[model samples]
Target: MTQESQAAEANASGNDNLLLQAAAPLLNAVVQLRQAVTHDDPAGLRQSLIDEIRQFEQRCKQAGLPFEMIIGARYCLCSALDEAAAQTPWGTRGVWSGNGMLVTFHNESWGGEKFFQLLSRISQSPNQHLWLLEVVHYCLLLGYEGRYRGSDSGRVQCDAIRKRLAKLIEETRQPQSESARPLVEVHPLVSSISRPMIPLWACATVAALLACLLYSALNWRLGNDAEPLLRAIYQTPLPQITVGRRPSSPQALLDLRQRLNDVIAAGQLEVSDGAFGSKVIIPADKLFAEQGTAINPVGRALLARVATAMKNVKGTVLVSVFTDNRPVDNSRFASSYEFSFARARAVTQLLQSQLADGHAIRSEGRGDSDPLLPNDSNENRTRNRRVEITLFAAPETLSNHQGTQ
Candidate 1:
């Protein structure tokens, strides 16, 4: 066979296997349900029905089928069967739905006949035929209404069963043996009949005894001293607090900033000075266009710090990076400063991709307009060719700050 034909056959075989596996549980449920009903125990039948439904649901999941549909089908079937069982011989000829069952006993156009005609065909002895009929009724209900009405139908069937049970109880009478029992039996006498009630407070004695017992129980369960000694053995220590001092001076800020910068620098990211601040720039052509060049250690480290800073920063901030500017590079930027902006944008994209909430970050690139220095000397030009980041107050912050100002 051709390769494509072989692959198709393999896929079909796999599907068949899955179906076979799923069928086992469903079959087991059906068997259990049958056994429960055969025993004539309503409680057992109900439990078995629940188990069967649960098994069917599990099978659906295993077969990668929609579990809800299976459940719906079961519900519809059960409801229909219940409705059929509850109806009198005359009431059996009807269609059932969420609203109610419709009975059509005699209608010339619709082959007018009492619905009891169907139930009358089944033999009353052994109850198996009735049980089988119930199952068939459920199946018919499922076929007519589909899975959508299963849940409602199932609930209705359960309610009908409960009603039937109540009616059964009302119709039942106690057996002769049970009803003929004596009202009370006399105990063997101990011979002495002495009554001693000298105190007038004897009536209140019972109330006092009950109050004492109640108080003791309350103290045992809720009183602090009555707490179990085992609990004290597993007690944990109180948590410790470590307060951090805030950086005040520009030097302190610079020191902390340097420490953070060192982590990014260690990663070996491309760095440059910009109009506002020193920045880490990612080479877009190397990182994006050509995926071969992996993000260097420096880029990863910088990304990490940027992610950390993002969490604490109350206002919206933009991170921009720059790459080497080429005159022939008609993408966007012409100068090094413009290239720096692109680099910053690349870094911003990287950060956003890494962080789950990165969509909240606002990012942009300014080609070469804002430069660190005059692009005259090579050294100055290199310094100018850099990414820039600025913190802009969030709208809420801006409004609050403006109000305060």
Candidate 2:
């Protein structure tokens, strides 16, 4: 395949990964809880599942958001989550980007508690499929050979579940005209309300309910401990972003995406469309030696290729560096923020000499504050440690600090 095709494929795959990460927690929980369905004494597993679900709920609290986690139900908790989505790590755009998912379940099998924790991870990625949880759950019921497959976990093997699956398949095969009721139900998120209410009370009701929902969902008051979880979301990917002043057109974003893909190695970097024009994500390891400010030889070579690619592209170039939520124990810089800023400046310097004078560049240091994923595992931490360079379509966006330093 061509380099551009490869880049497109990688971006699609990366977004899928973002969705999978979001869906894993709640999906695992629900799938596990479903496993307990076969046990004569499921209380043990049920209680354990509750504890895990509660942990995710607490983490949401740590993020300063309260969401409903229905323990066991057969329908998607769509609107409840839609309302709580804004306070989520990725916001509403992060929530699978599907207006209505789970439209193809074809049966009463539901994705609930076990899948809720994963919902946030799914939201973290762009253009995510909302139906992933349902697909995973449906496959589990069919005895699919995957981790979430219910057969391996003992839930799908029981005579009752087997009989139920057989019946579901038979019903799914029936012609819609011959069936008494439609096999598919529209997911609640996109389904219209049954009745109308006054707009005035809706605002007051939402305001009143938010407090009660948070209090009821969390039960006890938060102590002084959850402070570290709530940090400001990084907003300066572009220098000064004013709405309609960017991206000459949607086609402009597409062309920029293709151009970057031609020069940057697909495996080495990530390329995608952004609110600006195009955004490229490169791992810090690819750009710098460990704990050093200067760009390594390999990094310099990659940046050189990037500079050559955008030589004629006129736009605002921003080099934003981020650090994982780890202490800068032995680094020369005092903290992660300083270290990130220093690297951004170093990378920006390399690109300035090669690009045309019309292209403006600025460096931004976004410490451990803005992360794509929670800094929980070594793999996650590594993913969070990276650099972002955004090329805004609008020219002359930066008025100050054009290229000082």
List the candidate 2 regions with Cα displacement exceeding 4 Å: 1-242, 245-254, 262-266, 395-405
Prediction RMSDs, each to the true structure: 32.8, 21.3
* Candidate 2 lDDT over residue span 54-124, tens digit each: 55444433433223212111123222222222223333232222221221110111223224333333333
Error of model 1, residue 334, in angstroms: 7.9
TM-score of 2: 0.38
lDDT of 2 at 300: 91
Measured with C-alpha atoms, the lDDT of residue 38 in candidate 2 is 38
Give Cα distance to truth, residue 131, candidate 1, Å: 89
Best prediction by lDDT: 2
Off by over 4 Å in 1: 1-261, 264-297, 322-342, 355-359, 393-405
